[model samples]
Target: MTQPSPNTNQLFKILATGQFGTFLTEDGDNKYVLSMSDGGYEAFTPEELERVCPYTIQIDFMAGGGAHFKVPKDHGLEEGDSVIIGRNFGIVKKLDTRRDNAQTAENLRLIVTQPISTQSPQVVA
Candidate 1:
């Protein structure tokens, strides 16, 4: 399989609100909730949501056979929106069971890249 572009694997921070209690990872299952400070519940546009965080985006995939997407941690999450990791594979926002069944199915695959040093070790004099 061809490798994904470097930009494709970059991690993007977004803003979103959590509608219900959701987990980040399957193994750890880190529970994250939305901010109640902005009233009981409110609907925000993708751009507005991004302002809340900075990495939020309107994704199109699936979560547990249901449509899914990724937004910033701060973005207001709702029932329709699924909280997923950057590496959660599968149909991001579609009804594909075959793709959904695949474990570790990352929707918004976020990758962190760093520059490598090219300097070589100098001989002791």
Candidate 2:
């Protein structure tokens, strides 16, 4: 099946800090896929690796249970890429979908490419 690309500019407020392997984000206009890989961390150069700070983030859902995404440090988020309210609000640039054989259903999750936190807003303006 074909998947619709996520609007990279879409804004989502994080309801919880992704400190553990789990967190939460406000719903969006589209459904996203959860990534199963290390978001290309294994491909980083030594210099890049030295600057890396990896963390796993999984969006919390009412149904419960989801994949964990190991986001590489500085996952390319830049100015206007995110904001800071009580929690961090970020733009989701990538998304994916999952199909389970047992359930015969497809699930969507956002590929969290950056760390979510209560840190100062990364917005440039």
Using TM-score, give the best candidate's number: 1
Model 2 per-residue lDDT tens digits across residues 1-125: 54343333322222232211111221353333222133311111112211112343333333334343444434453322332222333343232222111221123223345667988878886
Give the lowest summed-lDDT range of ten residues in model 1: 21-30
Global lDDT of model 1: 0.34
Model 2 has a clash total of 3
TM-score, per-candidate, Cα-based = 0.20, 0.17
**In model 2, which regions exceed 4 Å deviation?**
1-53, 76-125
Top lDDT model: 1
- Per-residue lDDT of 7-99 in model 1, one digit per residue for the tens? 212221235433321112212222222233433423332232221212323334444343333344453443333444664433233232222
The per-model lDDT (C-alpha) reads 0.34, 0.29
Local lDDT at 42 for model 1:
34
Error of 1 at 92 (Å): 15
